[model samples]
Target: MSKLACAAEAGMLPGMFKRVVVFWALLVGAGWSAGLPLSPKEVVVVYNANQPDSKKLAEVYRDARNIPQDHLIGLELSAEQDISYDEYQKTLVAPLRKTFDDRAWWKRSKNPEGLIIPVQNEIRVVVLMRGVPLRIKPSPLPEGVKVDPKDPIGGRTESAVDSELAIFGIDGLPVQGALKNQYFQSKKSIREANLPFLMLTARIDAASESTCERMIQDAVEAEKTGLWGRAYIDIANKFPQGDNWLEAIAKKNLEIGIPTVVDRFNDTLPLNYPMTDASIYYGWYDWNVSGPFLNGKFYFKKGAVAIHLHSFSAEQLRNPSKNWSAGLLERGAAVTVGNVYEPYLHLTHWFDVLHDRLLDGNSWVEACWMAMPVTSWQGVVLGDPLYRPFLHLNGDGKMLAEDKDYLLLRSAAMRWGNDPEEFNKQLGMAAERLKSGTVSEALGLDLLAAGKDTQAAVWFRNAKEHFEKAEDKLRQDLHLIAIDRKAGRKAAAVQEIREAQARYGPMPEAKALAGWLDILEPPAPPKALPK
Candidate 1:
């Protein structure tokens, strides 16, 4: 059947199906879940056509993500950190607009002449490459134009490149200043977001090119094991709003089911605190790395995500040896977000929104973009835009110890496959411990990862047979689907999903997995539109 026909059969409009797919891709971040993997079809990579390094970086990302060649858009722009408003419009904006139109990505409406006029909503995100201008210089006031008294930045001027891209669909030059993010605090998944004026924007940026590449790789790897570390939030003696925001985020962290450590009364995470195994860390009001940082004594887990709020926190994302952003990345964080310039406390990332959104299952890029009040200002999200942190919530409750043990199987599987000498030694150990479905499932994943599909399938079937509860059975079945997909058995994966759904009948996991598969693996392509 055609893709549109499949949408119709699924009881959704074609546009709604696309939106649902986009929404699912953005929200489904974590391990062995029902949603689609982030696809190249949903991405558009923008590069400075004039810069060799920018082209090189864009190509690397595109190749890594399998982004379609047509999805790549380039513009000739100056190699400067900032540009005037006119220059922004003439160079970046105009070219971007033209590219979207040519690609049939920009929304269109029928005019009085019965012609299509560009509107909005073609793409979910625009990834600005390394060479693009990072900020826009404010235009001089013409003939005594008065600024809004309520404006925070002494007359709402200048804009960040990624932020301005959020408002790219606005008609004429946007002089009304920074656009407000409607999605803020809504905590809606991207599929549920009511975005009309702006498309989400992220950039593959850092102080250096190698750092940018590593950031992307880390995001992908982190998504594999899922976000399995700790959340450390440190707040000093607070300002009313700042304190409120910090407290709310701390509350949100607990609410979202992450193992969170909230240090509210202290100036920082106490120096003596054992701050190891951090997956997500947020601390603020420090001018530089503080006591909580522990002078490199702590070890951040692979794909760790951390952020520290300070004026120049992002001054050098490339320098791992430094005190701020780079230091966090160097110390092994998969992602870190902060401002490029001195964004006063209020203007920086809203802790509440950022935390809540991540818990709600938005990717790092989407969460950061949605939480930021002013995109054209200073806040910059640095990481893989596709990184989804909370994809493995097993029915609202945290993953049980058994479930965590299943996660450890990834390492065991690696050892089993890589160390042939140890495999024989481990075989005896597995015979004793592989009596349960959990261990069997881990073995299944290990074998699957090692390209042993037939053996993996046998282990998965064994897990299903040994399941103690309907819930356990359903969880293993869902996991089997992920394994099948990875093992190049998508057809078998669908069969497993359908069979589980039929047996389980409307369980949340079953329904979500079914819905995600329906949207992700559409029946077939409709005509020649982009995949």
Candidate 2:
């Protein structure tokens, strides 16, 4: 029987069946868009026709994702990283507009304000390939124009090329500053929200062609097994806003049953902090990629999604070792988002919102735009836009012990969510049976948050035993010592640190212990020997 018949047989209401069936048909062959409103048919791939790698990358993505043949739009463009604004309009935007009109990818209509807008936009996403220009250089202002002191962002006319492309449908927008994203914090999908002025944009780009290909493959692989492993959240604790963003993220992770490690240190995570099994990482305020990631031996888990917040985090896209985004990509992160220029903290991607959206099964691009307060400014989503990292939340109970533990804990939390006592009891029993360090650490963090430090310490200890890495155990040591320090056992905390410092030896993980030691025991100042 036809799918329409199936829908009818499934008891779809008379008025909604056609709409639902048509939507289902659009999703029938779209691989990465199962639950997302977007389909490959809605995506238009833009590439640099002048560059062999540009067009090649577009084809690679198209074949991999089974995008439609006519969706690929290659244009002659500059080989430089930064393009003039005029060139961006003439060579890129104008040509794209022409293509959309000629091909009837969308229908134009007048809004209530008589503004021309796409009433039925079939093309909702634009995928810019690697060789396309990364940023648009700010053009000179007119001779008579004067800057306003109160408008901080008005002076900045530069924007990420991808970000600029996202709003190509809009008319008469100012060149300076950013426009508020219509989809920011939106509870509905782009289609459902009828967001016609905006087109979700993403770049499948990296320092090298091989890395880009790997990124595409990794995103696909991640959706299969699920984005599994512990989350590493480095709280810069700079301001309440930034700190709260991270704190809420930690709370959400705990609620979801993902094992999370949160570093509350003001300074970015120190060098070689032994961050293992990191599938999701969010940290901030570091300019260049440093700290644990600096270790040559360290790399995140396959399909890991990491983002290190910085103003110019994506200043240059082709240098893997220079900034946070590319560096993480080269070091095995599948997806990351960043700003190409200086965007104020609040205007940047709301990391917590992105986390929630992804967990709620939104695609990467949708979640990214939903996370940002503004666009046509400087944010870029790097990786397959359709990657749904937490799609595994809809899984059967049969997975690896580590992966399965996440499922089991989430189930327990859902079943007894209203009863904290029952929730903890189920978690404790699962930790014992599964022998999962991730589950134990999750429970420990939850208990610690509830002010049950003693119980938290027990689980921390249990987690330490299950974990094989020395740094993992040392993290548990820090947890235990923190509990001791709270109980006015500073001396015991210091003693444990001293022993751990010696036991762990000169390994990079020992650096974290030494830091705690200094906090607990300040070394004596040089005696006033001269005095």
Candidate 3:
């Protein structure tokens, strides 16, 4: 069983018993909202004043995004990743509040809950540089208090600094577990809403300073030329709740003409799986980074956006070999998000919503905060928050030939969303003419999903012949093998499987074939005819 399924079966999914109560308390809003757009002017960049590199990164990002010069603020902070509560308030919170007050960046007034909060904020977004602390360690609840039943996570206090800072400007609310994100799933923007403003904070941080700088550059380049590549989604079939999110994402990508690989296996994409041209990736439930990422030879295409859904995926950002956020950054993912501590599943970012918003042209930070159930929790947004992967979706300027097929397919999909038959016909023509494995494989997957296995086989075969990468070709071969088995060509399927095993022995993909072989040719059944 998958991790999520096991947890659910074991009755260990936190807040499951009273999820309705928690959802009503935190997410009492309408259905998913449209993207809340942001401009560079509304952003404030923060960095550790004592660290020159931190300040330099802030400047580099600000200049790259054209943010206002005066919007930058620097404070002396601890060099550690985890900060104590008192240290957090004394060094980071208090100083930032003072800066906002002195600079007139916001107006503070008595909130109805009877605490001072930003009532009219000129700045609604914040960007933290690499050297700033990552998270705040948990503190004991004031004596004689028990866990809140209505909202189980409300009693826990450890959180990412970016998460906590989001609501620190809202009011002097006690730094507890999770608070209601009034804007979550709501169509209203902070300026247009009635509640006190909640600042949206993202960090341009990674394992190295150079990586941070490159992330900024990549975001800019991707926006101008557009991010065109396949999406690799690892679906941990743990439970329907998480599975639905990934399935929806794959469906959406298919409709939008982006080639996507949706792995239905309980685990992540196998090690060293042919994962070329990966511009987008979303997976979950691994304790730490694993699979192809561990191979050290697999690098995401330039300006790639990736995320893994482990509880402590972002626990540390300084070690390239450690957590999800750091490992992804080290391996060329330009944008990613994860939890700095144990963020319960319900409170974490809804990656499906994040993908939808990004496709709708929302900036990375806005998409993340817009999808999160609540801020002041444990999630942290890393990389350039202003990056929008689909901002130039339909445009074709001086982009490289490598991005052409993706642009062509995307433009066609956008133009033909209401008509599927016509869309497939056009895509098939493109695939045949271009002889692109990515395009051919995408069509095959779509066809397979539509239950046209015979048609899918043709495309899969074409993809196998055209693909250059060993893994890509093998992936197509697997698709063909499955189709052959479905068509009752068991002998042929078994022959091809053994041949592939011989061709790629000891590889993860070969291991998958071995699983298929076991199923097709099981151990000799006992001679039970006597019964």
Error of 3 at 216 (Å): 0.8
* lDDT by residue (tens digit), candidate 3, 247-360: 899999888788887777565665556677889999877877887687656788888989988888999988877879899988899999999888878788888888887776
All candidates: CA RMSD (Å): 20.6, 8.3, 12.3
Model 1 segments more than 4 A misplaced: 1-39, 108-120, 148-151, 191-196, 255-257, 270-274, 292-299, 315-323, 342-347, 395-531
Clashing pairs in 1: 29-391, 30-391, 107-119
By TM-score rank, best first, the candidates go 2, 3, 1
lDDT of 3 at 434: 62
Which residue ranges in model 3 land beyond 4 Å of their true spot?
1-37, 149-151, 187-196, 396-398, 481-495, 504-531
The segments of candidate 2 whose C-alpha lies over 4 angstroms from its true place after superposition are: 1-36, 109-116, 143-146, 482-491, 515-531
Candidate 3 or 2, higher TM-score? 2
Per residue, candidate 2 scores C-alpha lDDT tens digits across 1-531 of 444554345343354445544544444344333244578898999999999988988998998888998999999999998998899999898999889999988777667776677766788889999989999998886577678989888778899999999988766666877888889999778778787778999999988999999999888877876787778898997878878888899898877667787877667776677787889999987888887887777888878989998899999988887878999998899999988888888988989899998888788899899999988899999999878777656442124534555555555555566788877876776567556677788889889877888889999999998877787887788788778876888889888888888888988777877766666676878778665
Q: Model 1: per-residue lDDT, tens digit, 361-398?
A: 66777788767876566677766787876655322223
Question: What is the number of backbone collisions in each predicted candidate, taken in the order shown?
Answer: 3, 0, 0
Worst 10 residues of 3 by lDDT: 20-29
Superior by TM-score: candidate 1 or candidate 3: 3
Ranking by lDDT: 2, 3, 1
